[model samples]
Structures are given as C-alpha cells and as structure tokens.
Target: MKKYILKPGRHQFAPSSPAVHINDTLTDTEAKWYLQRFPHIAKLFIPLPTEGEVSTAKKSKMKSNQTEMEQTSAFAPPSGGKAGQ
Candidate 1:
C-alpha cells in the first residue's frame, strides 16, 4: 500500500512541514473520491511520489494560483478556512 502525506493548506508550499496520512493503497478512483468531499482543502495535500523529483515538480505546477480570485468562480469551495484570508 502506498502512503500519502496530507499537509494542511497553510503549509502547502513547505515540503518538510508536518502532515497527516492516508496510508492505504490509494488508487486513482479512491483518491478522487476522498478529494471530491473537499476539493479546495484536498488541493493542498502533496502526494509523495515513489519516483523522481520531476513528478513532484509536475504536481506543484498543476496547482492553480490562488491570488487571482477574479479568475475563479465565487462559489468555489473554501480552502478549509476563510478562503486564504
């Protein structure tokens, strides 16, 4: 089973911060299931790859930039707080 460390939103950009875990063999389908419950919050969790650093770089690039809120819909889910206040 693969282990996935879920860091909080505040520490999203910090690679060595504290984290929680989803220590099961999370298939693509299962990961999506948990993420759908809280997409915004889940977005911050960085899944550690068993492969090279390039994969991790690709993952970070996939994250949307939150500064430009005008580009995002107002009805979007909160980032588990006051929307990055």
Candidate 2:
C-alpha cells in the first residue's frame, strides 16, 4: 500500500491540511498520472530511501514530507507544555 497526502481544498483557506489517504500501490503509469494530477503532494507509501542514495521520484517525496514536517513543527507547543492547557 501507499499514500496520497492531500490538502482537502487546495487553497489558502482550505478546511484541512494534508494527511495520508491510504491507497493501493500504483503502477508506473498510474503514478505518472497522479504526479501530474497532484504535482507536489503524492508520494510512495513508505520506506523513504536513506540519505546515501535516491531516485528522482524519491527525492520529490522526501521534499514533500520535509515541508509538511516543518509546517507542523512551527506551531507545535514546546515539549514541556501541558497537553490540555
């Protein structure tokens, strides 16, 4: 299985943010179509390659994941903050 992370409305005021939409593994043709359709958001399901090597598609996926992480971390509370406060 793989995932397609999509922001629901694809707009600045979109109701929600990107999340994994669990999906079947895609064939190359299907992957290409999705890449064109969603551009920067779609990525392989898991197992991002280590830093030593990568394919073109893997590079794109890593970049997308990195961007998502950065956005999330920016507004997240510090480690000592109480969860419900």
Candidate 3:
C-alpha cells in the first residue's frame, strides 16, 4: 500500500512556500492533481516528515479513539442497567 505525508492543512499549501513536499508512492493521478493545484510542487521524494512522526500520528489516533469511546459509553448504560427500578 502507498502512504502519503501531507503537511496537514490549507495553510501548508501557501503560495510563498517553495515546493509542496510529496511522497514518491503516489500514483500518477494523485501526483498530477497535486501538481495542477500547486504548480510549484517540485519533486516527489521518499519518506516525508521524519521529525515528530510517532507523536503526530499517534496523537490523531488517540483523539479519535477517545471520542469514539466517549460516544459508546454514553450510549451504554452502566452495568447493563442494574436489576430493575
């Protein structure tokens, strides 16, 4: 499977930035779309965002799981709703 490492927001694609970093694994269609949208995207390279990789990725997953757990817990009553009233 191919993996992409984008800068994570609209601000990262600012015009003043020299080139938008991209992963080499991208298919032709993906590359073409990025290039068309951001003309200055110079090169496709291997393994982007080496710094803070684990923390950044894990943080997203943690938040998502936390939210899901909270929602599920809210729907499920404690101890399956005791014996009766």
* Highest TM-score model number: 3
Candidate 2 error regions (>4 Å): 1-54, 82-85
CA displacement after TM-score superposition, residue 32 of candidate 1 (Å):
1.2
Candidate 1 accuracy as TM-score: 0.25
lDDT, candidate 1, 1-85, per-residue tens: 4344454323322245454334343455655565666465455556655576868776666654553454675756576756546
Clashing pairs in 2: 2-45
- Distance from true position, residue 9, model 3, in Å? 31
- Please provide, for model 3 over 1-85, each residue's C-alpha lDDT reduced to its tens digit, 9 standing for 90 to 100: 4444444332233367744444444455675576679665533323455569878988999999999999998877678586344
Better model by TM-score, 1 or 3? Answer: 3
Model 2 per-residue lDDT tens digits across residues 1-85: 3333333333211125554233433355654565676665443333345555557668889999999999999878889896557
- Would you list the C-alpha lDDT of every candidate in the order shown? 0.51, 0.53, 0.58
How big is the RMSD of model 1? 19.3
The runs of at least 3 residues in candidate 1 whose Cα sits more than 4 Å from the true structure, single-residue gaps closed, are 1-5, 8-21, 47-85
Q: State TM-scores per candidate.
A: 0.25, 0.33, 0.37
Error of 3 at 16 (Å): 40
Q: Global CA lDDT of candidate 1, please?
A: 0.51
